[model samples]
Target: MFLPEAWGRGYATEACTAVLDWFAGALPGEPVVLYTQSANTSSMRLSAKLGFTELERFEAWGAEQWFGVWSPLTLSG
Candidate 1:
């Protein structure tokens, strides 16, 4: 999802929400993971809005902090 110019427009949320719904139905009773930098407050908020729960926080790629495993419950179709 590379919308460089579409930042802060809710485009990412819209696109991700659709994908999440499809994936949830495609794989039922499983966990979906979404990872991003801890510094990216917008992404964190978006993930939360999409019902992704935090699993861990760690450092990676030299001085870059990351939040891992925004776990969302998969739905059965």
Candidate 2:
């Protein structure tokens, strides 16, 4: 997790992209799941930028949670 001061920077995006790339290479055709609270717009946006597709929304911990899936097969050149 990034600190408040680290928000808005590309650190998270860059780091996540690298990790996803490695994951895809290490496990071809595997899918990953992402979970974030609906209140966190930044995370939601990041997930989208990372190519995660919305799976569903559910109430948890008294707040709406977002669930998304990311599959290496969905990656495009």
Candidate 3:
């Protein structure tokens, strides 16, 4: 995780993209799953930007959490 001071500047986007690219290359067409609290708007936006689709939402640990999934095919043309 990066320091709070490093929140913007696209670093997360770049790092996450690189990681996802590696995962896709390693496992052809596997999907990636993500979970985050609904209250985290930044995470929600990030998930959408990363092409993750909402799979479900549930209550956990006294908070509303969302489960999303991203498939390599999502952005593959």
Please give the clash total of every predicted structure, in order. 0, 0, 0
State the weakest 10-residue window (summed lDDT) of model 3.
6-15
Off by over 4 Å in 3: 1-6
Higher-scoring candidate on TM-score, 1 or 2? 2
TM-score of each: 0.70, 0.89, 0.87
- Residues 1-77 of candidate 2 have per-residue lDDT tens digits of 77999877899899999999999999999999999998999999999999999999999999999999999999895
RMSDs, each prediction? 4.0, 2.6, 2.2
lDDT scores of the candidates, listed in order? 0.70, 0.94, 0.90
- Candidate 2: Cα lDDT at 3: 92
Quick one: how many clashes does candidate 2 have? 0
Q: List model 3 lDDT by residue over 1-77, tens digit each.
A: 77888779788778888899899899978999999999999899888888899999999999999999999987754
In model 2, pairs of residues that clash are none
Local lDDT at 18 for model 2: 97
Q: Please give the ranking of all candidate structures by lDDT, highest first, separated by commas.
A: 2, 3, 1
Clashing residue pairs in candidate 1, if any?
A: none
Candidate 1 per-residue lDDT, tens place, 21-44, comes to: 777678755677776888888877
